[model samples]
Target: MQDFNGQIAFITGGASGAGLGQAQVFGRAGARIVIADVRAEAIETALAALAGEGITAHGIVLDIMDREAYARAADEVEQVFGAPPTLLFNTAGVNSFGPVEKTTYADFDWIVGVNLGGVINGMVTFVPRMIAAGKPGHIVTVSSMGGLQGSAIAAPYSAAKAAVVNLMESYRAGLAQYGIGVSVVCPANIKTNIAEASRLRPAQFAGSGYVENEASIASLHSIHAHGMEPIELAEHVKAAIEQNQLYVIPYPEAKEQLRRHYDEIVDAVLPMEADPEGARKRTEALRNWAADRARVFQKSEG
Candidate 1:
């Protein structure tokens, strides 16, 4: 997994933002790159940027939510590269903000489908292939700081990202035995076009039309103006992959926030009751759960 030279990388959302940053960095490391995005023009522009730098890369117009399309894209990638990608980045995402009461079904579906469902699709489409190839590989899925902490204004987005964080952790435990390392990236604000994601929502998922809140959009943009550059974050991702780290947290303050969140969860657990029999039974049950999980892993790796 540490090796990047001559490897193949399949990156979603690579038209811009962090995905594009990864393509640039990985391409420089001599990895063959496949940049996939729903926006054709953006993909063209991204490929052109890489081409200008003399990086070996190509683009595929992709919508990760489409299962059939994702399968076809996987096929296309193998045909182009002569093998499946050794690196898979499920980095595409979108968001919408409002009170939970104001959040429509369409809004929830759109945000969740792209942010969480897309990652699920990528994992399902690629993991089996990677395992069958019997090669060392890594998977990195980009969640957000908001995933660790819920946001009232962006409930659906936060919920979806949180799910991705948990999903990746589970995948990490199961895939480690198969030589497929998994990492979930929980990044804070970065200079990206996520605030404008609603504009790119496909018509099929646009249930209720979203009216952009200019003031909030402006505020988000202002904050992003001072955020970390995408390339710097991408470098951190590279280091995390090389080290086989589970979590790629770029913002320094995020560690404190996460600690506080964990502390609150710990505090919520009530003191154990003075019942030895109950405690013994609970311990046995938990032991059984762990054993079951271990057995599943062994069965897969056997």
Candidate 2:
């Protein structure tokens, strides 16, 4: 949105890392901030830090995975701000390292459950409320570069993030008519506490296939230590929202690698230029089907 003054920004995982960075950047630009997270201590700490900066921020203890809790949190925001948040951020995520073959159902449940399921919950819970309010707004989800290029190191994390990338694209197309802008940020490494995400893992998901020791955590921390600062990342995100940009990827260092990967994908696909009749038939068929199933599909234009 072009304006931010007096806008309510509800940020998931707002206690630390990327979420906190958004709270700082957006709050400084005159938006009221809500820091929702699972850790009560972190929420208080984040609130105090924002208080020192004279930023208008409130804290809500939340576990985004719980659909009921997410609904309650939405209600809480309405009660506190007397309105729905115009700026919704789905930024909470988790990661773990293990061989894909060794990864268990539990691993997928915890990692994907938080990473993807949480975003789904947020979208379902808030979209209706925001639409009912009939205000121009924006929704931003934090994905990862691994989402674009799959990672053997963290398969579940990569898979969930990849889904997030596609999900935002669909939302962008669907929400555009409602004056709601949607953007997905596919970031590389960032200086954050995600390395210690294991510490926050609930006991119900304790059965893990990956090793979660100090050494592994430290290794992740060291890699992230050399990564981009959260505030700087937030600056890129702010610009993307203002520009209505679809992809918020600021890592130029990754250009050559991504280009190479995309090239391979293109090489694998059969060029439509060589099969004009087939392409025309396929397009016509889809258009006819979409027209027949109008209620099930968005209308396509000439």
Candidate 3:
């Protein structure tokens, strides 16, 4: 995973933003780029931009939610470029702002379908092929800082991103034995068209029931307006891949917050009062409850 030259990369949502930034970095490193996006025009535009940079690239129209389309895109890349792509980026995502109580079923479905399900689809379709090829490769899943911490206002986005973060962790642990590296990016804020480019809410959620309230939307917009450049975050991703790092955190300030949060958890665990009888009873009850819960939850999938 250290070297990318002459390798092939398949990037979802590569038409713009951080996805395009990753594509640019890979291309600059002499990698063959396959930019997949739902917007045909945007893909063409990205192709033109890459071409202008003298990069070898191709554009494939892809809606990551469509499993068939994802498979076909992977097949096409292999047919044209030889072996399966070595670098796979699951970067397509959307944002929803609002309170959890106001959120509707459709809102949850759309966000989860695009963010979490899309990442799952990409991994399923590409990881096995890469492992079979027996080549060094990396899977980069673009999660958000919101994924790391539950943001009160953006419940749907936070839920989806949290799922992505955990999924990447599981994927990394599972793939490590196969020599396939995985990196999960927890970006705090980066300048992108996420808000403007987000898909419209379904009619079922559009009126009042939508999770994103006006205040929260305004807050997100303000943050977006002041976010980092996409390329800067992309460089961080490239550096993480080069270093074989599992977590790629782009914002330094946000890292401090994360560190503080972890410290608080550690502190909370360290100050235990001596209470043998109470502790034993509590532990046994907790273990029993967990055992019961696991039996019921065993059949469910994340």
Which candidate number would show the highest TM-score if scored against the true structure? 2
Query: Per-residue lDDT tens digits of candidate 3, residues 222-275?
Result: 878788787888888889998889999867788688988778888776334667
Superposition TM-score, candidate 2 onto the true structure: 0.96
| Model 1: residues with Cα > 4 Å off, grouped in runs | 207-216, 273-276, 289-302
lDDT of 2 by residue, 1-302 (tens): 88889999999999999999999999999999999999999999999999999999989999999999998999999999999999999998999998988898889999999999999999999999999999999999999999998888789999999999999999999899999999999899988999999988888998899999999999999999988988999999999999999899999999999999999999998888999999999999999987788755545542
- Top-down TM-score ranking: 2, 1, 3
| Worst ten in a row by lDDT for model 2 | 293-302
Candidate 3: how many backbone clashes? 4
- In the predicted model 2, the residue pairs found to clash are none
Candidate 2 regions with alpha-carbon error over 4 angstroms:
295-302
Model 2: lDDT of residue 92:
89
CA lDDT for candidate 3: 0.84
- Give the C-alpha miss distance for residue 178 in model 2, angstroms: 0.7
Error of 3 at 202 (Å): 6.3
For each candidate, the alpha-carbon lDDT, in order, equals: 0.90, 0.93, 0.84
Choose 1 or 3, whichever is better by TM-score.
Answer: 1
